[model samples]
Target chain A: MNSLKPFSLLKRIRERLDLQIALAILCLATAFLFVGGYLNYLRAQEQERTGVITMVREMVAVVEGNAAIAAYLQDLQLATEISAGLQSSRYISMVSIDIDGGGLVSTGAVQSGRSPDFVLELASPFSAAETVGSIKVYADLDYIEKLAASKGRSVVSGQLALLLLVSVAILWAVRVVVTRPLGSVVRQLKKINLSDEGSINQISTRSQDEIGYLADNINSMLSAIHAAYLSEAEQSRRIAQLERKFRLIFEGSHAGIVMVDGQNRLSLANQAFQSLVAHLDPHLDQQEPRPLSQLFYDPELVEGILSTVRENNASVFRDLKLAGEQEVWVRSLFSLIESQNSAEMGYIEVVFSDISDRALIEKHFEYGATHDQLTGLLNRRGGEARFRRQVEQAQSRAGSFVLCLIDLNDFKPVNDIYGHEAGDVVLKEISLRLKSALRADDVIVRWGGDEFVVSMLAQSSDAVDAVGRNLLSVFEQPVEIRPEVWVRVGGSIGIATSDRVGFSIERMVEAADEAMYIVKKGDKNSYQVFGDSVARSQSQA
Target chain B: MNWMIKAVWILLAFSGSLYAGDILVVVSKDSPVDTITKRELVDLYMGRSHSLPDGSPVMKIDAPVDSPVRAEFYQALIGMKVSEVNAYWARLMFTGRATPPMSVTKPEDVAGLLARNPSALGYLPEDSENEQLKTIFVIKEDQGAP
Candidate 1:
């Protein structure tokens, strides 16, 4: 069976190439042989025809003088004798001579319809130049043509036989030397499995001709194919291993990782990213892709980050608050994922790390920086910030507010008589009274020992006067400094309105202090407003 | 005595060379033919015409086939050997186209035959000519030697 396989392959190759070559050679050689043989037959036939004519002409030549003598003598008997002698040749059908006196002497036939093949002008036997008569010899054309045709057939057949022999010899040589070797090479090639490296085998040939060169070429080509296949297989194996390593990293990481396409839609989300998204909106449909922007509390913030990433091809890190039932914070890193092919649209890689605990601690620090410890209200630093905000609100609303500076009139004498603890108890009682008397949105601050500053929105002079009366009544009742002792400390108050002081906090406090000095000089425990006359005297002072 | 015989033999050879000269075609002096050309003589002997150009009917005679004069005469006249000339005549005679001329055995008999008929044509050696036969045409051996 194995031997038969090679033979079948050989037959297939032979059927395609070798058979065609042999058939082409046979067809071409046969056409040329027939044409050449036909031309040769024509030449031989012509030669045979000319041979018969030549023989008849030579026979006529031999009997020419006798016929001429007979013509000269006007002798019918001698003319008959000459004609009879010429008629003895097989190629001559009839012979005749014309006597000088216009008499005709013929042998075999008196008249023949066809033209004569040979005509000899009979001159006088005695005198060389005298025209005596003519003798015409008719050739046997039928017999001569038959002879020539037979000769032509023999020559053509011999040539045809020779052409056939040469064609067959060439066909046999081609089959032996060319097709058989090539077929064996093809059979060996079919057995090769290129994926199993080193399966390529060299073609074997014994001849040192063109067939040997062909085998060498085929072997080299097979080696090249095998090498290409081996490289391809190795490359695919390496790529699969690398893909598996990347998948492990993506699944195992704690940080949320997402790949977003050009449209800002999430293409691939790792388990960490999915969990982060679930924390943001537990009811979110995981089956359908959601826009990366919807995960943020502010879509505008997300869009700003995305635009920056597109323009710079750089990473943007922002601690963004996610939109959800509970406040979830994440530090998202937005970076461009570059496409390997320049023609493809790029993607973005986002990494989200939860940072809500850090955010809560930072908020506490922010609140501590702005509040007072002892009063549980805004300190001077905190009050300055509050006053600036109040000023901004007043300017925007086109309204006015009052700033009051209060100094205790008898606080120093009481402090010396009752000691420091009793003075502290008095200040605490006054602070509690101030708190109870003012509105909830008022700004109150302890300026220094025995001094206080308060601010409240007031749009009219009447409203300012009413607030002044309300502040003076806080010292109307004396405070119990100890369990059994009572002490009264009256407050001398001065007020400045924001419209009169022009929006500067320091200038407003200075104007109120000047007003309080005036009030202390006039009434020991009362309130005074810095009117246009006081502002004019102060500017003059 | 042997030298005298050798001299006599040399004399005979010299005379033989002299005899190989010319042959004259002749007719009897009593006939009316004064002169003839080679063409007219050939017509008469080769049997193309039996009458002379002047219209005198004449009989023709020949020397015997083996005679030297006959060989020389035919050779000089028609560039033929005696045997070829005989063949030509044999064909003519057998077909009954024309008759060949009567032949005489000896050279002297040619003059005797020409004398018997007045209009008789014959050829003889130039030296053998006599008054009874008039020379009309001379077949020169050197000019037409064949």
Candidate 2:
């Protein structure tokens, strides 16, 4: 089974809140029915017991009445006549007369040896002058037993039927009150598409319950997310603008732009820094932000430059030497730019203009440092800095977002079997496909080789899935590097959503990378959402 | 004329034999074997029982299912109609505890069954019995004997 995506499941449940509520109601109703049935059963049993006891008591009363009459008859002078008269009564089973001291003077035709299962009563009577005799009567219990049994059976059956009906009604009621509503909510939640810019705002719940309150909260959260996304988008646009402006400034300026902070950290190294150091280091393009100490071979020369900048607190122009064996001409100008926030001294801007014949070569190296050689995608360092700035802007706005790490599935095989030239063509084709699949707001950076990083200002996971699927579909067709040899490769994509995975770019990338591996393991042509088990496994391994 | 006279004489002789046969109470063979005097039998079949002097289990049986004799027997003893006996049995059977006495389709079947089982007892025509069955007690046609 595909590993459960908890966020997707949560989304689905939220959409169908009505169904969940209805189910809960149904369960509650069922419970009520059971309890009601049990109570009815208990009531019936109690009634049956009481009825039986009453029947028995009534039988006893009949027996006692017969016994009293029999006793009264025995006291009379005409005991036999009275006994004979009592015999006329149809219900009397037996009648016996006994003297005060004598046992059983006379008994009716009924036998007496067997134990009496019927109700029996004995009573004595007294004459005016003296106590006479006693009499006993038996009242058959079979009739009472029959009556009670029939009544109990009917009552219990009736009660059981009532309980069954009530249970069904309660269950139906629960379904209507809870399950149906919950199902509606769940259906709505299922329709939520986080990838759509305005989709989150469309969620509407009209209930006055806790679910309604939750829906309202979710709506506000979506608004917050949308606002954040817009702000982040604006920030990215600004960063691009700044990068363009910086590129123009670096290339167009006659004076070299070398920007350094108080910590000796190089902020920006324009064309002049490269020119000044090119002769001393012919491979100056490879030496990025070379420390002032590394640039100067003599430690005393570096100390002089540092002291001039520290003491003057203004522009300090000085002539510096090539750091190593190759002697080069360099002019260094240092000026402190005011800190954007506090007046505490900020980084010093150093301008190094090369007035040497190597200036043309250094200019070429500077262009290569910032620009990507292949596909024109941002290089690793440039992409990282841009991504960090974007993340900061995104964090300030608290927007819903996604980060995707994409790797070509079969790019390695293409390079191994077909050659680097064919592999490069495939990579370019993949880059074009990725660019076409993304929105203008999204950023696609070729991290290097076969890997690309994409950042989207999407509102939901579904948006990420859509973009991933689009990229996958675009790559599905085989690329014809030549008329003869066709290169077929797939892309493995991992997507991490900001809302679920949080707002950290590194974490998002990690999750996406993991998710991408999942795509590779499960379906090479598909995309996997990060932090959704499939992706995490790739990260873990 | 002579044949008609002879037929009349035969009829007279048959009637005379029936009248002299003592009108004994006959019970079916499947009846509960009870030895009851005329008064006691009258009381039992009439649904009257003060007590049992002999304390023997008593059950009463009637003639064939639709026989007029059965109807007359219940009327004379219990002062109730044959239908009343039927209704009584229906009520008794409805309780599901007790069953009415076993019935026979014919008086002869009753006699044959009674002759085979000692526990079987029934009042039959006085002259109809053979030596196989015993008559412990007799119920006179009239209430003259106790």
Candidate 3:
């Protein structure tokens, strides 16, 4: 691992921007230099060759006159001397002079008739136009070529050096101008912490080139990202705070709040909701989500509310009577919490509040409205309501009931002798005795100031007379108004059977009242049957 | 304009020396050669040939190296300066094949030498009082003239 680390570092350095740019420039420059240097070498070679040719021409011109005189004389000795002189030059490989009609004088090794580089026709010494002989100077071609090649190589070498220097300079300039600043900007970006309250640091560059422009754009982008991040954080903070507030409302409410899933199982419940369920079923303490229906005594009531709320997408209000010895009543609201996404089902949110106190108060008001405050029995209004219900039952079943209407005899004289308070005491004592005489299911009413009514289900006329005799015995006993002050008040009784008068309570009461008045005119404190009185009257007529 | 005429007169005087000459090619009075052509005379003195035009062998004579008459004789014959003529002969001296004319070292010794040998050839100024030799050819400033 240790040995490989430097190799990895070297690889990373090779991948650096400055080194990569330098390598690219070096490759391109080397290619162009190769091409340009080759062209320059060819040009130099050609120029040097031309220069060598010109030098050889000048050498031939220098010795032309001497060669001509020797040719004209045809002196073999003089010709040989001139050839030797010309051969001394490095550019001349061989010199040969051919004298007309004479032998040829030569210097250096004469090859197999090789053509000379330069040929001059010699003129006679005394005449300008006379043709004498020819002088041939063979130029050293190998030496000339070598000279030209050396010159061309020197020129190409100079160009290559210049190209290398320029490439190095360009690589340095690019690193300074572009790559280093970009690396600095990247490092600055990495250092930025968006969560901090401080502003993002901007990259500093003096040059007004593209790198500076890039720094400006990056700064703007960083600020934008930072701003977005900050706002998102603040929004989440507010959402959490709002969630806490809603949680307080849920937990601190007097009303029980419960959230149940679509499967009728409890998903969430506040403390109040759990307490309310504890009242219904105190032993229920399993942690796993139990069915919300099990929390209610009447599961059907909860099912009805859930169905109604689900159908209407609205709230349902119901008063539930929980089953227990304690008269526990609850007002419940079940609302459908709509699902935000279409794919999921809605939840049912229920709120339950204990209304038992209010229910008991309402029951008291109802009892006070129907019963008589003085005697604790059904009053005239209450008796009429009962009488109508009894008539309805008798008609529906084809059964018979006897209605008795009773009025006290000489009760006003007792009220005149004793005070009204003493009259109330006598009335209370009579009501107790009347209640004791009849069956518990019998309907009794205080019909007027001195009139009392009793209704009992009867099947025959003998049963009707038996109830009439029992009610008359209630008034036979005297009620003691105060200590040692007693009042004896007899009641005149008139009995009517439902079979004779049909199921109309008003008709039955009228028939009984007329019989009681007849009893009051004849014998006070006696009993009379409504139909029997009519028969008795007819017998007398 | 006066200076210009002076310059022209100067120029004419210099040109008169270049074009006019007085030299004569001669031999012994008793020799067969008389009134020789310039070409045959050139061949004898310049060493292209050792014989006269008639094909008889002959000896050639010349004035001393420093003599003004010798300078004029060769100048009128070949249109060359004295130094140029010496260089031309020096080239032939290397070959040992052709030789230049024999010199007498004194202008007075040329007549004696020519009188001793009939086949001898020599040259002198045209006004020279030498009865021992005869004029074979007249040399002039223009060597091309016939």
Q: How big a share of the true inter-chain contacts is recovered in candidate 1?
A: 0.92
Please report how far candidate 3 places residue A100 from its true position, in Å. 3.7
Number of the top-ranking candidate, with DockQ as the measure: 1
Model 1 regions lying over 4 Å from their true place: A1-15, A108-112, A251-255, A260-291, A306-317, A323-328, A336-347, A353-541, B1-26, B29-37, B51-57, B63-76, B79-97, B105-113, B123-146
TM-score, one value per model: 0.59, 0.39, 0.47
Steric collisions counted per model: 2, 40, 0
**Candidate 2 backbone clash number:** 40
Q: lDDT tens digits, residues A188-234, model 3?
A: 88798999877777767766889899889888888999999999999
All models, DockQ values? 0.42, 0.01, 0.35
In candidate 2, the second chain superimposes onto the true chain B with a TM-score of: 0.59
Worst 10-residue lDDT window, candidate 1 chain A? A532-541
List clashing residue pairs in candidate 3.
Answer: none
Q: Which candidate leads the pack in TM-score?
A: 1
Superior candidate under DockQ, 1 versus 3: 1
